[model samples]
Target: MEKLYQVALTMVEGVGSIMFRQLINNFGSAENVFKAKTDKLLKTPGVGKQIAEGLKNKNLFAEAEKLLNEVEKQQVKLFFSTDKDYPSRLKSLYDAPSILYYKGKADINSVRTIGIVGTRQATDYGKQITEEIVAQLKPYNICVISGLAYGIDIAAHKAALDNNIPTIGVMASGLDIVYPAQHQKYAEQMLEHGGILSESPLGMKPIRNLFIARNRIIAGLSDIVIVIESAAKGGAMVTAEFANNYHHEVFAVPGSLTNKYSEGCNKLIKDNKANIFTSVNDIIESMNWDTEGKVPEKNTTRNTEIDLSQYTQEEGQVIAFLRTNGETQIDTLSWQTQIPVNRLASLLLNLEFQGIIKALAGKKFGLKL
Candidate 1:
């Protein structure tokens, strides 16, 4: 298929993505496009003046030849749509990439995959929730997918790696370029455990448009997407929107109402694009995912000392508030339970760390069911 590598050849200047695909459909392959006369190209849907003008000089394959050489030189692999290793879930999307460049060792054909996405400036709350949920997703042989930005993205990757779950980072830039260079170490580590994926050619820098395009692959590549944190507007919401468009499930961990990072998630649940998650179990159950064989329901099995004397006043207050209200806001715990704000903060953080209660959006707290 070396000479038949028409897809790579079609990706050159002038053809662009849309026109390249249209030409492929009309002519059957890049070789045919090269062999076809001008009128045959114009007969293709969405292939017109610009594309014909672009292909006027058949020598344009020079760029594609160089790109292919770079791919081999960099040890990168490419997957065209419908390739056996092409993610079937992603291939079903309307906007699935016509080509993808990959590096590293992820199988790409894992049993299942889920995307974890969120803000660059993730909160401590966001980090904790992401790690705990990823830890729970560990045993399902599911590959975790995400953008390789900071905060929740890195946390998810770390947790997945720590738990031996393969992960994939979908990039807005070329595989040859790494965006937000701080992730260099983690990206290298992903090569050992998972892989990095990109739709653009080598040397392409990340642009705003690229990130928007990148989200679709993240959504399409997975059966579901879990929003770890997002602003009232950001890439995570974009991923959720793409997941909704792709007819896939979207899950979000509710954060404090006062937190800027949680606003997008609250909007997603309110808009009915994403389900509300209080625990990893909430996410799995809401998606109708069978967690029975996937992973042990961690917090569902509780062990406790039947004594309140050993607990501090703040801990006592949080527990009482949960039991009384069934599910109550953290603020109400301070107000109704008469615990001071400073102390309530410390206690709830501690209790959350203990997994005694699940924190929901808007600073709401609920008893472990």
Candidate 2:
């Protein structure tokens, strides 16, 4: 019943991630949000009368119920934002999807993840480099991520399959439909070790804006993003931009400047937006990753119970919020704690310096795991 309301809330005409957060915060749950009076809904921040009225539509629930049935029939998994299994790296971003539809066997929250993106019109050199990069990364036990398109995207996925590396494809279409249908074979093969994921609803077709939106997930899911080849204005460059904004480490292979596909990579390097990707060593050094083929142990030293009396009231408030909400953007912390952004920024820096909390991509902060 809760899952049904969760899906129904997403079907509301104007309810997006931010609004969904606001509703959940105010109502304490999606089911409550749906049952709230129109007057109450109108008072919630950013929930205009129009959106509030849209929540009253009974058809949304019927639609959501149908989708849920389809998902169950197809063996698709739904990851809500509050789910423990949701991707931790993406959960802190302001615009991450409220729900994700996933299929296949790979762990989306793997210990280490890398996103590989490039132009669909990849050259042989680009394809070879992508393959080599995946192969080299095998020993580190990386989960490869890409859009699962043609050219370098497919090459990376295929390489991961060959290397027995878990690879996830963030798709523009629904999980039931694979765009560029020729890659359906590879998509099926991925189910053995990797998987395909999407935020779009079942039966949704690939569209231009959706592809652009899908790039953010690729950027958000990765600890690092590597652009293999791209023209000045293409999907790969867009993904790189999203990565930079998210504060994820970005790397671009230096390609021949004369090649049109290399223009984006060179420009990214020139602008100091991405590091030059020469070898696997670049990623190892940048991320300080271990190459010994061992998974790092979780930090069990941090006690779950904290003595709030040891900290100032404001600091205690921030800690309490983070304790309840895993990773959160600084702006959200400010809004929730009623602290000015400037003051919160300094306070967060102090906490980070004290090793009480760590900064993450997109200006988010979380207690050290």
By lDDT, who's the top model here? 2
TM for candidate 1 is: 0.76
lDDT of 2 by residue, 56-168 (tens): 89898889999999999999999998777787777767787999999999999887789999999999999999999999989898999999999889999999999999999
**Best-fitting candidate, scored by TM-score:** 2
lDDT of 1 by residue, 1-369 (tens): 533356445555665555555666667877777767778777877767776666666565676778888889999998876465676565544456778889989888665678999999998888888888888866556899999988888889888888888999999999868888888888899999999999888999999999999998898777778998999899999999987766567888888899999999999988887888887777555444465545323342233442456678668766755665555544435556667666777887887787777775424566664
- The estimated TM-scores of all candidates read 0.76, 0.87
Once fitted onto the true fold, the runs of candidate 1 whose alpha carbons sit more than 4 angstroms away are 1-10, 13-18, 291-369
Report, for every candidate in turn, its global Cα lDDT versus the true structure: 0.76, 0.88
Instruction: Return the lDDT, model 2, position 207.
Output: 95
Off by over 4 Å in 2: 302-369
